[model samples]
Target chain A: MKKEMVCISCPMGCHLTVEGEGDNWTVTGNSCKNGERYGIQEMTDPRRILPTTVVIKGAMISRLPVKTAQEIPKGKLFDAMDELSKVVVEAPVKVGDVVLKNVCDTGIDVIATKTMPAV
Target chain B: MYDIIVIGGGPAGLAAAVEAKKEGVDNILILERDRELGGILNQCIHNGFGLHTFKEQLTGPEYAGRYIDMAMDLKIPYKLNTMVLDMERKDDDTKVVHAINEEDGYMALEAKAVILTMGCRERTAGAIGIPGFRPAGVFTAGTAQRFINMEGYMTGKEVVILGSGDIGLIMARRMTLEGAHVKCVCEIMPYSNGLTRNIVQCLDDFNIPLKLSHTITFIHGKDRVEAVDVTQVDENLKPIPGTTETIPCDTLLLSVGLIPENEISRGAGVEIDRRTQGPSISELCETNLPGVFAAGNVVHVHDLVDFVSQEAALAGKGAARYVKGHLEEDINFTTVNGDGIGNVVPEKITVANLDDSVNCYMRVRKVSTDTVINCYIGDEKIATKKARKFVPAEMVNFKIKKSDLEKYHDGELKFVVEPKEA
Candidate 1:
């Protein structure tokens, strides 16, 4: 199969062409080495990070925003968001506070971006 | 005695004044450097402004006209052509502002509170460090716009735009419509910083070529711009050694970026945000100094004029509260930028009184697909949003509900941009 992809690794959108035969793949048209590797993995397994709001208790607001500290499996976006929805933290939370434990079991924590006050 | 005296008479200043008046501020005046009430809007002949504020599509002048008419109806005091040169804080509640106009020379005023809304200035070739001899055909995009749209003068027959900003894209089509051949638009960045609609309508629709990751390495000209040396760049933004192309053109318009005009703000001892090159303020638009406020481009460069109006209104209202002796000094919490984020606006956050919501504006340092922007209040997550694509060109606006703000008592607000899960 021949695959055409746009390299997002940098500002230079290098049109990538990937050819795969039986268990082997050859990539070309990548301006940089990192983009070549990114194209290969993007062709195989596409993953993304999940950023969503979570329920907050004892804070002034009903919900506080949180996101996976790093990228997770692209196929697990809904699962990650579901996990984040069920996650809640007490108010007076500080920035970078870990609100969720074992998010998607990817060993990544869901962290908060804004400070919240507690009564 | 007046609590605050705002500089500039543009939409930003006008909106600020109106907001202050609506907040019951009786002693407020606006100083405009132009004879008319509207600033840049006086010459903007196209539509597409005021979609967020009035919920109606209007031209730049029309939108500013609406606000000016509103200020007039509200009897907002404004002095035309009053150029503010210097500003300094008198004590805790007073500031000294000096200005000059054709009618009055070296006029000075004192106010209890001050609002800086001088707006922004276009980035010139000198700022970008482009190598070129002094020529007659080189002009800023805004200048060419004013010359053609307002002064009814032709800039040139052939043109080359240096940046893909909104103004440049708009001018690409404008120049094309005026029977000028726009050779191309050169941008060093991979993704365009302009609005998607503009890229489609202005460049794509007009059949203008947009060269990504390319820059004008040098200019070749004597008395007028004759040609530009275009070159592609590597990942590090350094021009690649072998790839160099030249295009012939008589005029070169630069729409690189807009810098906030805040010399007066710095002179007034106001805290400046290094990232946005504007003033750092709380959600109320109150600066670090008491009785001083900032809004619009003077605070941060806004892509849409409507957002500028919205922000200016907040500053105006905040100033009114300061004059009425109702401004809160409980701005204990501060907003901090985290990983992947370029900068955050309204650098301070005060949840002391959670009556109204707060809007936090920020930008990303790089472009990413399927990204997640998270807001953390110290150790806890307050908000997060999934983004399909994030670019440095667009400013992200996030609103924290008053109810949610009440939950977090005290901690620093942080914004983080990271790639989304697979």
Candidate 2:
């Protein structure tokens, strides 16, 4: 099977073409090696960094922006959001502070992207 | 009185203030109407930022935090929740910034130089005049982002987004991730106005349909949004009759366009660029008013936050130079957007600086394949950049070296796109 995808590795947005499926794919039309990697990953097991909000207590703002420290399985995005929905943290949470550990057993930690001071 | 006053403490303003401090300018102040610093970047939580500036993909807040840390280390003072009402020259040199806040109600601050970096605002449904009843569910993409990302509020369950701008495309994914059923995204143009990366990661990944050459002709619902009438547009962007399709949706998100926030700049008697709807600036980011500099979205809308920081640095450097009396006085040539271009920034090139190359950014009018962006000083073709694809959604960066501008005498430096020769 042949597949066409856009490499989201960078803002360049290279159009990628992947041939031969099932763990043996040849990616083409990629400008760089990262594009080729992204194309193959997209064709195979796709993963994405999930950015969402988690409730915060004693902060200037009510919610804090958080994202997976690394790319998690795309299928588990909603599951991660569900886990985040019930979780609340005390303020003075700095950027890169781990908000959730091993979200949905993906072995990826969701970290705070913004700093929140105690109000 | 401060040495320099920066309006809007967003990425642009924060970067400008930091650069100004680094340039030995003391007693600088930043006035932000928001409750905290970092501005819009605080709401923009996605990745794909800081590719150029930091050489690493970072979330918007991380990028803003770097500059915020820099400004803090420099000990540059900033006033949050301070709204700058007006800015005008008190005399030939002194720029007065009139602002108000609960702490300091109605105060006029004086500064030797002012940098306008008020950023921009999203164009509402009213701006496009989609025939509709004023509904509560109609929200701009940025507003929805703020509500969902910052305030932890769900906008709606069923959504119909109008315009395929980056924000709209991002929201398609955002709404989907948050359990909202985004019916479709309708863009009136034949091609999307958003970056291709967004169209894929934000929409394609989520399997959201992007309807090109389609528009929301009418918005439905009495109190909250219930539905919207989508229609196909002809070549001239006219809605075709009898082709209306109603999609049941509780929210209509408008990610149509962004206009540079320049009301205060105009009030300060700065010459506004009709093309960009922002302040006209030289290579140094200095406006018509010598001491008054403008950069980032206040001068022209930028697609990338990294470029905004680069431009803001120029404004900060220009402000420092103006304070020390080192800025150039001669305007050598003005930039002209030739065929197939719109709203090129750095309206004028004052002088060729040995330190930094003059960076020029422009948006193409339409999508063109296998083209070369050519820059010509009168008849002499000075520089050319070849591209496989050129679209209005992506900005073109053309940097003119000091050696390239050395031979040019004066007049207009025009940038145009032409088909690649065989």
Candidate 3:
């Protein structure tokens, strides 16, 4: 079977084509070796980190904005957002303050992109 | 006599005029030197703009069209083919603008305030220090873009593009689509200066090679360009030995960079920032001259046209305030560029009683990962935001809320970007 993946390791999204038998594979169309690993992973499990603003109270605005510090597993994004939806961070919170620690044990933290001041 | 006179008919001018009008400055006129409206957008035929402000995909012309349509609907007065030569502020309320029209060779126009939105000019081969005999085949990326997109002229069959900026990258795909074979895009920097999307859609999708940390050492051509010698560079951007490779091509397209057009700003005795090459304004976009305002590419090179529109609107509104005798002359706070940041616009923060939020437009010196940009009012950190990827090509924008400005009453406000913990 042949599999293709767009490598996002760099700006050059090399379209890597791979022919594999089970776990073993041969890859082509990749300008670099990083694309090979990306193509193989796409065949196994694909994931993306979701960065969306979550509401926060105790600030000037009714809701403060937050985002995932890094991409979590693609399958766990929904559960992550669900966990983030219930969480509200306090103001005067610095950037990189973990809003939700170990969200669903996916080992990702939803962090604040901007600092908010407390009243 | 109008309240405000906006120079240039580009997206920046059109948006600025519309914004000024929206702010209740009725008597406004947009002066465009071109035969028609829609400045640079008239020549650009690619579809990679307006993702930020509009939330939809649009080409350059399409984005400019939206603004043009809005300006027309607002009944904003505009004069086509009118080139402004110089401007001087007579007093706090009066400004003399010297301009020339196609029919009328020269004339002096009076206005209450002025908005400079002349946009920018492309960096040519001579500016980049490309050693070669002056030839006809070498052209700036914008020039080539106009030639191909507007005039329907194929630049060349075989082309080597210098500088991996967005214009060069887009032109690579454009030339290829027009049946021209592009050899490669060479850059002195290790990373791509253009947006990640452009690198993907323009170069990667088209199978064009982007050579990083490399530059064109010399050009080989007699009457026209025949080939170029490209060499890899060391850490200091000095060319490394034994890494020279000559690529044979008939034409060399320079997508090097763009410089803000501020020639008129200098003529008016306005203090220009060496870095931005534009007039140094305060939070109000008011230059050192009292009634003169500057915005858009005349202020700095913006990645997105939407940001240009947004900034120009502020300048337009600010100009209208100056015209209506509601502007304050005393600026309390100053804007300073902090560590890791290249430059920040609106050199000072005016409007003692800060109401609306202020937007600081800047660029980083180098590529950084997982960085947090902090805006400080003296010692107090007013705003801080994290970024995934930071590149010099990408302009970093930081918005300061009115509340944030109120926290620091008076001091030099510094904006800095520092690396964050991974």
Candidate 4:
């Protein structure tokens, strides 16, 4: 099997061609080592840093923006968002404050990106 | 009278005011139209900012907080909810700024130097002449950004975005994450106007399709956007007959382009460049009006906020010099766009005013690889910088040292991109 993808590691956006199946793959058309690594990782277990907002109470704003502390499995994004949708945190939340600890047992915590002062 | 009165408390204005204070300018005030500082950064919740300035990837608010914290630590004064009405130069060459707010009513400010940093606004559907009914579902991408990111209001469940701008691409992901089904993004041009990373991360990652050389011909529905007839266009952007395809969607987001907000600058009688639709400025960011300067998006649209901060710092330092009676009046040479260069900032440069080097920010007309940006002073080639890849979506910062400029001070300087192999 052959898979064609664009490398998202940098602005270069190199078009990579990954060949093979399962855990073994041969990646080409990569300008850098990072692109090659990205190609293999993308073919294997694709992950993304999910940045989204959750509901907040008693804050200047009604919502608090949060992002996964680390990249989570791409397949679990909707499920993670489902978990985040039910979350509601109180204000006085500081940056890096854990919103969802170990979300979905993925070992990636959802943390506050901006400070929200109490209303 | 204030030493420096910065207009608009966004990233550009905040950086300008802070830099001016750092340069020994005591009386500096920043006037912001918003209720608080940070400007548009407050609504931009994404995390791709400050990679160059802070050397770390930070969200929009986090990037802005760093600058806001710096200004606060330095005791810089700024007024919120103040809308600058007009700016004019008095007979004495001193600049007077008029503004209004509910708290202050009407107020006039006097400054030795004024910096324009009002930033830019998104181009709407009307700007692109999209034949559409006046509907509630049509919203500019920035407006939709504020609605979703800040106000927590989902614009629609089914969305069709016009124009492949970075904001549009980012919003595609935002809407998809928020459970909105994005139909597709259509671009009239063959190439995307947005950055390449956006296309890969925002669109490709989410399985959202990008239709190039296509545009919305007609919009359906009177009360809300029901569907849009999208058609592919030829090289001249003329729609072909029988090629219209209607995509059903409730929302139509236009992410066409951004125009620099320069109503105050135009009222102040600053010379405007037709290409940039912003003020024509010198290397020091000084406009034709003495004691007046402009930077950031108000001068030209920049791809990176880091460059906006860097440019505004120069304007701040220039204002400081003007107040301290250190800025010299020197002969300036005009910078001309040659063969593949689209536009060049700092329309002109004065060798005597430059400190070490003057960075000329520009864009290429098209995409090319393994190219060389050649700088010529008349028939003499002065500088040539190699670029691995050049694209219109990215802004190129080309630096020319004062020593190199001083050597050829008489003629016009031209910048052209040529193939390295040639």
Best by DockQ: 2
TM-score of chain B of 3: 0.97
Over all chains combined, what TM-score does candidate 2 have?
A: 0.98
How much is the lDDT of residue B17 in candidate 2?
93
Candidate 4: docking tier = medium
- In CAPRI terms, model 3 is classed as incorrect
For each candidate, report its DockQ versus the true two-chain complex: 0.01, 0.84, 0.03, 0.56
Per-residue lDDT of model 3, residues A1-119, tens digit only: 88665665544446678887778988888767767876776666755444444455676444433445554666675677567667766777755577778888977776654445676
Q: Each prediction's Cα lDDT score?
A: 0.79, 0.90, 0.79, 0.89
lDDT leader: 2
TM-score values for chain B across all models: 0.97, 0.98, 0.97, 0.98
What fraction of native interface contacts is shared by candidate 1? 0.00
Tens-digit lDDT track for model 1 on B1-422? 56679899898999999888888887778999876677886555444577678765455656776888789988988888788999887655578889888887887799988888899999999999988786889889899987776455779988999899988987887677566899999999887888765775578656799999999988888899899899999888899988999899999999999999989888878889898899998887888888788899888898889888988988887888778777778875788889988888888877753367788888889888888998888778888867557778888887877677677677788889866767
TM-score of each: 0.77, 0.98, 0.78, 0.95
Better of 1 and 2 by lDDT: 2
| Ten contiguous residues minimizing lDDT sum, candidate 4 chain A | A6-15
Best by TM-score: 2
> Which pairs clash inside model 3?
A49-A71, A56-A64
lDDT of each residue in A20-91, candidate 1, tens digit only: 855577889876786677677777775444444566788755655455666567666667766664666788
* Model 1 misplaced stretches (Cα beyond 4 Å): A1-119
What DockQ was computed for model 2? 0.84
Instruction: Name the DockQ score for candidate 4.
Output: 0.56
Ranking by TM-score: 2, 4, 3, 1
Task: Give me the runs in candidate 4 sitting further than 4 Å from their true place.
Answer: A1-5, A12-40
Scored by Cα lDDT, where does model 2 land?
0.90
